[model samples]
Target: MTNVLILGANGQIARQVIAQLKSSKAAMKLTLFLRNADRIKDIAPADSTIIDGDTTDTDALKKAMKGQDVVYANLAGSNIEAQAKDVVSVMDALRIKRLIWISTLGIYDEVPGKFGEWNNKTLGSYIQNYAAAAQVIEHSDLDYTLVRPAWLTNKDEIDYETTEKSEEFKGTEVSRKSVANFVVHLIQEPNLEVKHSVGVNKPNTDGDKPAWY
Candidate 1:
C-alpha cells in the first residue's frame, strides 16, 4: 500500500484531496498532518492517521515522516520557506522521496500580459515567499512536483488544464476542486510529472484578472 502523508490537511484543496483519496479504490494509507488536530478531527477519514504539529519542528516532522511513501504539502504563510526547508531536511534524512507541493502562479514571472502585472502587484511579497520555498524544493534531490495554481475559487467543479514551467501560465482562475483533482491524479500515478513544476487553470477563463477582481 502507498503511505501518503498530507501536510496542512485543513486547507481547502488538501481537504478535497483527502476526500477523493478516501473514496478511491486504490490501496493507500493516509496520514493527515496539520497545526491543530481538532480542526480536522470531524472530517478526517476513520482509517487515516492525524498528527498536530508545526512543520518547522524537526522532531515533529521526523515523527510524521516515518514509513511514509509520499508527502503532499499544501501549506501557506510568510514563513513558508522555513517550512519547506524543514520538510526537505526531514524527508532527506529519512531517505523518503516523492513530494507534491502547492505553489501559486507568477512565481517564475510566467504569467503573461496585463494579468501578469496584476498578479505581481497583487501578490507582492507573498509571491516572493512562495518562490523561495519553491526554490528549496527544486534544489532538493527528491522526486518533486510543484503545482502552481492560478487565483483560486471555491467553485465545486473539477475542470482545468496544465502548463509546464517553461510555458506561460494561462487563464486567471481555477477552482480548488480542480487543483485537488490534479493532486489526486499525481498521487495515483506517481510516475507522472516527477521533478516538474506545473501551472493549473480553468480552460477559457483567461483575462487581465480573475472575475472577482
Candidate 2:
C-alpha cells in the first residue's frame, strides 16, 4: 500500500479528502500532521495515523513523514516558504518523491483583470506567501505537482477542469470539496505527468473562457 502523509490535516479540504478516501475502495495507507488532534479526533479512517504536530516544526515533520511515499501539503500563511523548505529538507533526506501541494490562483499572474483583482483583495497576504512557497517546491528535486485553485469555498460538487500553470484560470471559485477530491486522485493514480504545476476550476462555470483570456 502506498503510504500518504498529509500536512495540515485539520484543514477543511484535508478533512473532506479523508472522508472520500474512507468511502472508496482505494488500498492506501494514510498519515496526517495536525497541531491539535482534538479538532480531528475520530475523523480519520481506522487504519490512518494521526500524528499530532505542526509542519513548520522540522523535527515533528520529519518524524511524521517517516516511511511515507507521498506528502500532501495544505498549509498556509506568510511563513509558508520557510516551512516548505523545511519539509523539502526532510523529503530530501528521506528520498520521498511525491508531493501534492495546494497553491492559489494569481500566484504568478495566472489571474487576470477583475478576477485577479478579486483574488488580490480576498487572498491578500496569503497569496503572496503561497507564491513564495511554490518557488521552494519548483527548485527542489522531489517530484511535485502544484495545484493552484481559484477562490475557495465550501460547496457540494465535482465539476472542474485542469490546465497548464499560469494559464488563465476559468472560474471565479472552485469548491473546497473539488480540491479535496483532486488530492485523492493523485494518491490513487501516482503515475501522472509529474513535476509541473497546474490550475483547476469549475467547468462551464466561467463562460467557456476566462474573461481575461
> Which candidate gets the maximum TM-score versus the true structure?
1
lDDT by residue (9-119, candidate 2, tens digit) is 988889988888889897888897888887877788888888889877888888988899989998876788998899899999989989999888878877767767766
lDDT of 1 by residue, 22-63 (tens): 789999899999987899887788889999998988999999
Against the reference, the lDDT scores of all candidates come to 0.95, 0.83
- Model 2 residue 207 lDDT score: 42
Worst 10 residues of 1 by lDDT: 36-45
Candidate 1 local accuracy as lDDT? Answer: 0.95
Report how far off residue 24 is in candidate 1 (Å): 0.9
TM-score between candidate 1 and the true structure: 0.99
User: How many pairs of residues collide in each model?
Assistant: 0, 0
- Residue pairs with backbone overlap in model 2: none
Global lDDT for candidate 2?
0.83
